[model samples]
Target: YLFSQRAAWKPALTLNGFLSASKRFVEKDLEVCVAGRTFMITGANSGIGKATAIAIAKRGGIVHMVCRNKDKAEEARADIVKETGNKEIYVHILDLSETKKVWEFAESFKRKYKSLNVLINNAGSIMSQRDVNTEGLEKSFATNVLGVYILTKSLIPLLEKSPDPRVITVSSGGMLVQKLRTGNLQSERGRYDGTMVFAQHKRQQVVMTEQLAKAHTNIHFSVMQPGWVDTPAVANAMPDFHRSMKDSLRTPEQGADTVVWLAISEAATTNPSGRFYQDRKMVSTHLPLAWTHSSALEEQKLMSLLEDLAKTFQPH
Candidate 1:
């Protein structure tokens, strides 16, 4: 696995990094109030996703919360409604690890919803063990990569219908250390390292977002690293790291700041699409002098592989 300690520097992913980066953010640029626009956010039950939902809801935007749990989604919806008093919050449940179910859900979503102004690919999974599903797909890859691809691909037609369509994916800084590896997309080779596997998936996401942005000019696509945040996912996935970095991690809201800005602020869209973002500014996908870059052929293979995998689950 391609690993670089310099790429995933501790201070860069800490709260101090956020504070430093946020100092330059144009506060006035994010005052947009989308009273009628609809936003779909996955894993909106809690953490950065939920924080983004709350921010949009407060601005009078209709929120479609895509969550994995019914009870948790409803609870989060209630909280958003109570806090924002917008009352347009809606919830849909589907496990991201279930590939066929994700495709079916996307189809059903198109039939039900008319407009989706923005689609936030926020939900991600990092499994400690290399668990394979019924389709023989690894759990983390299925949830983090294939599931996102299916949902986003299926809804492209609907997104194109919107006047201001944008797709923002929440990737990780951990991806900086890895390159897009189409040869072993399912983590079948070498020792099972969850962090590295997840990083590879995140790297794939960055490349995929870039490719999609180039393919669809009408729809803006962006990927971002939210820095280190204190959330349940982090706590569950890396308890030791979470404990050590407890005081240094950013809050869920702080982590969601850039996401909310990208969704609402016109300044964000003014920049080029398919670019990687940190805080509110566009940043390079690769680290300084890092050999994590992949060839055009590799990126193409990734999309093709995803398409082939998705075709098997297509509702014929």
Candidate 2:
């Protein structure tokens, strides 16, 4: 019932939330030009991903837009190019759920590019119905957890060598509702609930980021909650929630603000890695008194499992 209350969740995830947060934003943090720095954003065709790409491109950054559909990606690229006049934007197509292809894409990308200054793991999916890919992984698990784990792990070497390298994953506030359940990361259990599963996946991402940071000190790893935004994904995945919250929802740019800040702002990197952020401030991954904390052993299990799975599908 707490999750269903407007007084509980709405204030923190709505337009009013963004407006209040933006009042504290430092305008000059985004002033520096990034003519040579390269940034890659997954799911760049729309929503927070597209908005983040535009923010980077406008700063003269080399933007690599990764999307599942070529048509939508190219269309988005055209618009970004027109708006920013930064023609360095390029599009690459690869479905996140296809874990093998994601590995191939990263390997080839490493060979094609000299360096990737930052990687924004912005792609995510939440299905209304349960689905398992041919590889036997749940659809949202494949796309949200496994896909992100594989991509970030595969790209660490490249990122570690680059200047001011950072990885900003666009996670969500919904994850606070979930505890890390490593024994069933794929949701191959009893009754499957999409919301709970996605929340779990999002929670997995937070743990993954924290774990990755511990192992790699050269690169900064951050996971953030982009305030609830009016995006096609939201409408499609949760129509009822979208409809009721339409007026209160934030714009894509507003939702993407913290991501942009974290990517380029000096203030963000100064804070310790592995911490989660919302509205440009470092926030706790768990809500106070939520009883959602996972044991250290549970967190370790998540990393080991993901690492093992990643090795199996890595390009030899």
Models 1 onward score TM values of 0.97, 0.97
Model 2, 23-121: lDDT tens per residue? 988999888788899999999989999999999999999999999999999999999999999999999999999888889999999898989999999
**What are the lDDT scores of the predictions, listed in order?**
0.92, 0.91
Report clash pairs, candidate 1. none
Give a tens-digit lDDT track for model 1, residues 1-316. Answer: 2235474565877999988887888889878889999999999999999999999999999999999999999999999999999999999998989999998999998998888899999999999989998878898999999999999999999999997899999999989889788988998989999999999999999999999998899998999999999999999999999999899999999999989988888998999999999888888898777899999999999999999999998888
How accurate locally is residue 285 in candidate 2, as Cα lDDT from 0 to 100?
88
In model 2, the runs with Cα more than 4 Å from the true position are: 1-9
Lowest lDDT 10-mer window, candidate 1? 1-10
Residue 112, model 2, lDDT: 89
